[model samples]
Target: MTAESALTPTPAANAAGLPLALDAVGGDHGAVPNVDGAVQAARAGVRVMLVGDRVKLHAELSKYPGAAGLPLEVVDAPDVIGMDEHASDVRGRKDASINVAARLVKDGQAAALISMGHSGATMAASLLILGRLPGIDRPAILTHIPAKTGTVALLDAGANADVKATYLAQWARLASTYLKVVEARENPTVGLLSIGEEDHKGNAVTLEAHALLRQQAGINFYGNVEGGDLFKGTTDIVVTDGFTGNIVLKLAEGEARVLFGWIREALGSSARSKLGGLLVRGGLRTVAEKMDPGTYGASILLGVRGLSYIGHGSADARAVKNALLRAARAHQSRLIERLSTELSGPS
Candidate 1:
């Protein structure tokens, strides 16, 4: 496709009705969670095309007798990309599940691509197959963080480990647009993740990005935010390099697990504590549900010509189901078309 044509917004009527293409053989547990998730989503009326080894997929589907009545199709993808494989391997692994899934989106047979595979390979497939959106030099990954009041959008989560100031500025715009178009948050505020709240407190790159963001139109720049600010609900969106953002994401995940483990240990320490735990079990369950990463499902690879989402490598059936549902919702919302318009405007 020509550059101009690739940049043009795809009409919702043509792509919105397509089925979601899922990499059924690409997660930590292979087709188990993927098939279950596909069954769950299909049961909910979302059409899903599972791309992977046809035999394995069929065998898994057979485990769920009710799945036969659901809208689920399996496409043959005999190869599976390993988690340790480099993203470049996608070019050689012609029939890899993720590659096939991406191709389905590019060919208009799928509205979006969802994979719980090697995230690097998934991102590569999206970039190589679907191409980048207009005005986007490098696409970024966007993940939602549960905050004090609501969820916060964090971008460049792991897509670009090393980035230029311009990339950071662009990600802020992308994240803002995503929040507005998909999350229904109008004029969302942005925060530059840094060591301190002051504009001058960040490194040279952040300092430069801060100036550019200040001059950028349409977004509500909220200056700089510290690491703690993420859970404080300090801003609607947060922008950082993938290196730092990935570290922050990992740290947060680890901390949450440790904290919950401690809570469980403390609750079971004695009969008195056990009674207290039971009393607050309902409230704790609500909090836990909100804090669960699976609740958010997948991180969107924004700035792609087509919609792409990357879920956790260790994703469960619930997470996969949520990811498929989220992808369907995003396609129905005309997210890619809206994003094209957002990026095609003034820098």
Candidate 2:
């Protein structure tokens, strides 16, 4: 089929709904992991639409047994936006894999989108294609971050570099609703990221947001929380400007990697240490799994008209599979529609 027809609107899906659009190219490792995730999602009963190079994607899918005859379809989209390219650089490449994925959602042929490509390109394609839901000024890159206890849901992970107090209040509203409704966490606490727990200790933007979030109804707003509060699971939902949220996310990921590396080195440093490690292998593995980024899949780009997920460029097959499952769950929960409703309601 031609590129244009491959992307054309198709008949509406059954009541079960359209398949998820998995962008199968432009990842750091290539299309295999993306297709692998698609296969897993299909096996788990989530219909998938693989969007990428026809020949390469099909070749990868053929390598996996039982991939054929599953509720999965492929849309030939050969164009790709490299990780190094700027977001706007994708604007001209309408046939790019990510752009096709977004278009599938736009054309009602896909229920959601999952990709580990250039994040900026993901956001740009999503905005340019699906656009934002009504009443949402900007889309926040939100992720469900696993912690020692319960998970912490953070918003504006890296979407808007510049935002206002009002934007943060919106993030609180959407995040709290998601945690309560989707995650089954009743009355999820909303914490404003700041230097100190005191409300007055933040900068002008955060100070203003503190008041705004406090006034917002339907959310259990906590006072300002510091960086330490994030992993402590001190609050269920943490709201911050994109700049700070991005920093917190990257730093935490880096620290976790370093900390785990240190542990591995110390465990193998001596024979006695190795013996202890063997004894606690199961316990250590349990802890490691919880800390692993793949456990949570990718971050959800909330406030968009449709469900959109963005994973790390270097995500492996496991991460991609988890990301697909997460996106399917988001679609089943009607997260995008619920977020829109909440935003339209009272502050």
Instruction: Mark the regions of model 1 whose C-alpha exceeds 4 Å error after superposition.
Output: 1-16
Tens-digit per-residue lDDT, 246-341, candidate 1: 998988888988898899899999999999999999998887777788876788999899999999989999889888878877887789999889
* Candidate 2, residue 249: how far the Cα is off, in Å: 0.9
Candidate 1 displacement at residue 161 in angstroms: 1.0
Candidate 2 clash figure, as a count = 0
Cα lDDT for residue 300, candidate 1: 95
**How far in Å is the alpha carbon of 336 misplaced in model 1?**
0.6
246: Cα error in model 1, Å: 0.5
Ten contiguous residues minimizing lDDT sum, candidate 1: 2-11
After superposing candidate 2 on the true structure, give the runs of residues whose Cα lies further than 4 Å from its correct spot: 1-15
Query: What is the per-residue lDDT of model 2 for residues 173-273, given as tens digits with 9 covering 90 to 100?
Result: 87887876566678888889899998789999999999888788889998899898888888888999899889989998888888989999999999999
lDDT of 2 at 224: 91
Give TM-scores for every candidate, taking all chains together and pairing residue i with residue i. 0.94, 0.93
